[model samples]
Target chain A: MSRHVIGVLVENQPGVLNRVSGLFSRRGFNIDSISVGVTERSDVSRMTLTLDGDEKVLEQLTKHLNKLPDVIKVTHLDAGCVERGLALVKVDVSSPESRSEVMQVADVFRGAVIDVSRDTVTVEVTGTEDKIQAMLDLLREHGIKEVARTGVAAMARGPKYTGTE
Target chain B: MRNGCDVVLESFDAEGVDTVFGYPGGAIINLYDTLYDADLNHVLTRHEQAAAHAADGYARATGEVGVCLSTSGPGATNLVTGIATAHMDSVPILAVTGQVPTGMIGNDAFQEADVTGITMPITKHNYLVQDADELPGVMREAFFLANTGRPGPVVVDLPKDVQTAETDVEYPSVDDVKRGIRGYSPTYGGHPRQVKRAAEAISGADRPVVYAGGGVIASGASRELRRLAEITGAPVTTTLMGLGAFDERDPLSLGMLGMHGTKAANYAVTESDLLIAVGARFDDRVTGKLDAFAPNATVIHIDVDPAEISKNVEAHVPIVGDAGDVLGELNSTLEEMAVRDGSEWREKVKRWKREYPLDYEESDDVIKPQSVVEAINQHSPEDTVIATEVGQCQMWAAQFFDYTKPRSLVSSGGLGTMGYGFPAAIGAQVGRPGATVWDVAGDGSLQMNIQELATVALNDIPVKVAILNNGYLGMVRQWQELFFGERYSSTDLDQVPDFARVAESYGVKGVTVERPSEVEDAVREALEHDGPVVLDFRVAREENVFPMVPAGAAINEILEG
Candidate 1:
């Protein structure tokens, strides 16, 4: 029942996401979220997956994943890290007062104004899962229109590094 | 100077590796690019999971550290199950994946995923490369960790930029590499006193039985196990995971004891006066009721893993060491001591086998799994390599197949991973091409990696696949029928693909059998084919694997056929 977040470093290529996700599915592992993107290295990519299993299962899974030919490195991220996700929430700006209230709430969370229309305003918030939830909660009072959220992605905090393989 | 991926590969080649299996993905593209022109060769699998299993099979077959590659996100995650399988089976393998570049790592950048943190618990050791310079050392260290100690899988995660970045390469020799796992040495020979005690116990017992397991094969102690059995004149019963450790046809053999085991096998375990358990974990499936299991017996256990000692059934004498080495010492000690034959005990076991022999009804209306297995035995070569997937087929393989050579029967015994047979057969074929390799799988298990037929075709490996197509998750269905009043739920696989078409799609020849008479002909044709082939036989679905002891029931409570 121990949950874990694994930070994976890989080369950017097609079908990689499916390959990783399918693995979890086939083994009947419950994966909460998987976030992927390009990194500072244009050719490389990073993915963070949150999954839960026992110590023995985790040990076996990690070793098996490392054996893949395309994988460059797989790191099980430590909990002592600043983990975060990005989300965009669109609120119904039916009135001028509603738009102002939304702006005030976004400002409180340090969220940026991404898009706006006569009847709607989209605020992009980047922070910890709790922070994003807070912003979403505040905006929900103003009648939420739509939301798109990037799944949780994390990294170690401070000068600490997982180290390169 | 070397990038992370280049550094990893160079280190692997230095480690004397020639082959790796993987699938390319966003995060791992850079590594594949570097590997393409590198001295190391890579087998591009359709799925990352298959790559991991292939590596596992390679490791199991060759005793070499197998390697696999995948990209970030799903690519990295896909290798998890395969890695877990290898770990459970104690196979050595290395999985490498590429990660997002340093700056955009957690920005939800396209195709980025954290592999290392996800795989921590599944691997022996895992490394995430934050610096390019450490790549070579990490790869070397990964290999060392994988192959040494209690051999298992290790992981290395590399960032893309780091792989392409320049760094000085410092390759470490095999002997120079340092490993972190403690007390993991595969060769832990037991002390002399332990052997003497074990020998004395064996000699003194009136009704002794040698319970052999895969440890005998892993320790290369099959010959020693045989010698011990012959010297003591004790009949041997095996765990499901221990099949083929002793010759199945040997007169002293009691096939697969415990739950779902032969009645004679189970009875022998419970009735024996002394139980010599070797290289076995005393798994619940084997013990059934730990309290009642071998209740009348004085147990002497020998295993490589110390943790396994006294973890399940309490042992009167526990010796932790390599099964072969310790058994060898025990054999020498027995030769020196005055040990008498237990003819009465042997006769009792023989009587048990005769009284409740393993049997299955076969009529013209249905193709029973037992009949299929018997046909396989009738047709297979003397040194045939038969790999079975888990469930009914695996049990049948254990019961029916006569394995004269060690490693002749490869199956997911401990882990019981479904779809293990096909990839393992390919690996076995690669290891021993002269031996006739057959992947005998049930329909439920075969579909797990049915796509591996393409691997066979692509690699030109002529391993034959025998599908016991019972149109259901046979084992689970059988359990439901026997225990759950036959209220089948999601057990029936009515939506199975046309196996022939599926095989043809992969460019492999496919043969179908509807009658029992056609079984031999289909198998023979597949064996004769110059390339990979699949023989799908429509076996009866309701056929239960017999001689089953209900979970936690005493060994004596075996339900016979």
Candidate 2:
């Protein structure tokens, strides 16, 4: 099985997401992550879904999605597409030495310190999955207290604008 | 004033909706009022649910979109189960429900039950008209969606005011209607590469089995399916909904596959190297113990609905298109490809068919449900339409009836809803005037919508009901007896209603068959009836539908009793 990311443009309407999700679950699709947001056009919404399945399974899922009344278009995002995620992690800074080390690690990853307290430092990291994971691993040594992640949103990379056609 | 009701008439006229099965109620009085003067034929049913089912039967029988109407609240809620039944079977039906005045929506207005929300999941598309102006467009889209690609039921919830308020009734032309609805286009022709791949797989395999489903009939692909099977010389099997899609008399016919399926069909599936699934979803009942189902076969699924292609069985070569169109391409591709000799495979399938022919015990006192259905099959004219309710009777009918034509056998295959057959028979009879229609039902299921008898009688629709009155919910009873050690918990009917007498009271002909000898005569009498007729056969109460693969058991590991 291979991972496939599909970007769908659907007419902005209530319950379209539920319909899309229900279609996936009905076919036993294993969706790793799904992100939905309003696109450049307000009348249409974009849903970027990452699912793991063979070529046949992905093809069927794509067809089913297209059958939805609310769906306008579906694009199978290429493998070389750009995918990014955002994460916020809080690390305990009980010791001065640990706090200094955490700051240095955050600087190297280009992560910004969003909040600072006597016992904790909240850092915001934005990048592809690997970059986010590397930042989290570094913060772990300083007793990472909490982590929140926004699932990956993806798009095809090209010279011309890919407006979900 | 040309009101929303005029919009309804104009829309139906433009869509070529000749008949609507429905009932009049408070919320939809305006629609009923205008319907009285409209150019369409309206059959007033006893209940809203029956109307929905009748519409489904109508669609199944005629291969055209069926229409049903109901008032809001209890009326709309009543249509839910019927809508779900149509959805499951992929029957194209348009249900127009009258909601409370727009202002009263969501306020729990008397008799209102969030009709739109309740029917959302069950429908292909639904609309609660926000403006009277949108009524025409919604109706047009409802018909288009319901009859398109994976044909299914669609709902249009019109408020009382919407139907009463004056509005311009401009029925959009077909092309104009197309532009308004986006994102729901269904592919008719499959990808050429996939079709060629499927053809190659079929040609390469010696033991290939062609399994088809209801989609074959819905897409009018049965003729193409027969040609494909003939060209490949592979054995063919159908799901219950797929009956009549293939000629049962053909040597290649394996009847049906799955739970309670024929021993031959089940064995063919297990032993086959290539399984060509046409227009069929791998339903649990049809694929007992999913993991072990067709374990040896490489599946090639062709269907209009992409979701169903890989929903149950993984399709090695999946084709998402209209069944007829896909099968047509497959047939053409196979014509050019190197054809393998499937003669050996054909001989083995014939042997399996001979070894385990469908049968039942002969009783002197109680009617064998199988014998009753078989007798009907014998006495009925060619091309008789048979609608069945859920339970043992449904299985018996499926096994015994020689369905030779598409749309000849209509039943609740996917949802397995009871009380479906009787109303569906009404719809079928209404759709094809002069055609004989039979509701092969179980006592438990017949009682669910027995009220439809009044509608049948009033219309003089000559549909007949053959009730396998086993005095218990036979299917569930059989399960309880086998799996639950015969606890019989709530499975037995304390006092069975005299369904025949009930039908007589509704001004329809009624017959009761208690002795096994009377099965043939009773079926004949019912068939000859001028109006609706009900034949209540006091069948063997303890009868079981067999070749059953006990739930969760492998398809090949069946109890062939």
Best model number under DockQ: 2
Chain A TM-scores of each predicted structure, in the order given, are 0.86, 0.91
Q: Which TM-score does chain B of candidate 2 obtain?
A: 0.98
Off by over 4 Å in 2: A1-5, A21-36, A50-61, A76-78, A83-153
Tens-place lDDT digits, model 1, residues A1-165: 787888877657554565566566655667777899888777667888777787656665665455443456778885687788899999999966999999999999999999999999999999977799889998998999999998788888789765333
Name the 10 consecutive residues with the lowest summed lDDT in model 2 chain B. B176-185
Cα lDDT of model 2 by residue, A1-165, tens digit: 987878888888777887788777666777888888988889888888887788877877777777778888888985678988889999999987988888888899888999999999999988887899998987898899999998788888877445644
lDDT tens readout by residue for model 2, B1-561: 477888888888877899999988999999998888777899999988999999999999999999999988889999999999999999999999998898988898887877777887788888888778888888888888889889999999999998888876577776777776667668899999999999989989989999999999999998999999889999999999999999999989999888888999999999999999998998898898898988989999998887777777878999989999989988999999889998888999999999999887787877888998899899999869999999888998999999889999889998999999999999999999968898999989998998988898888888888889988999999999888999999889979988778988999888888898878888877777677888888888898998898988899998855
Candidate 2 local lDDT, residue A114: 96
Regions more than 4 Å wrong, model 1: A1-165, B106-108, B179-187
The lDDT of each candidate is 0.79, 0.88
RMSD of each: 11.1, 3.5
Of the true interface contacts, what fraction does each candidate have?
0.00, 0.70
Clashes of each: 100, 1
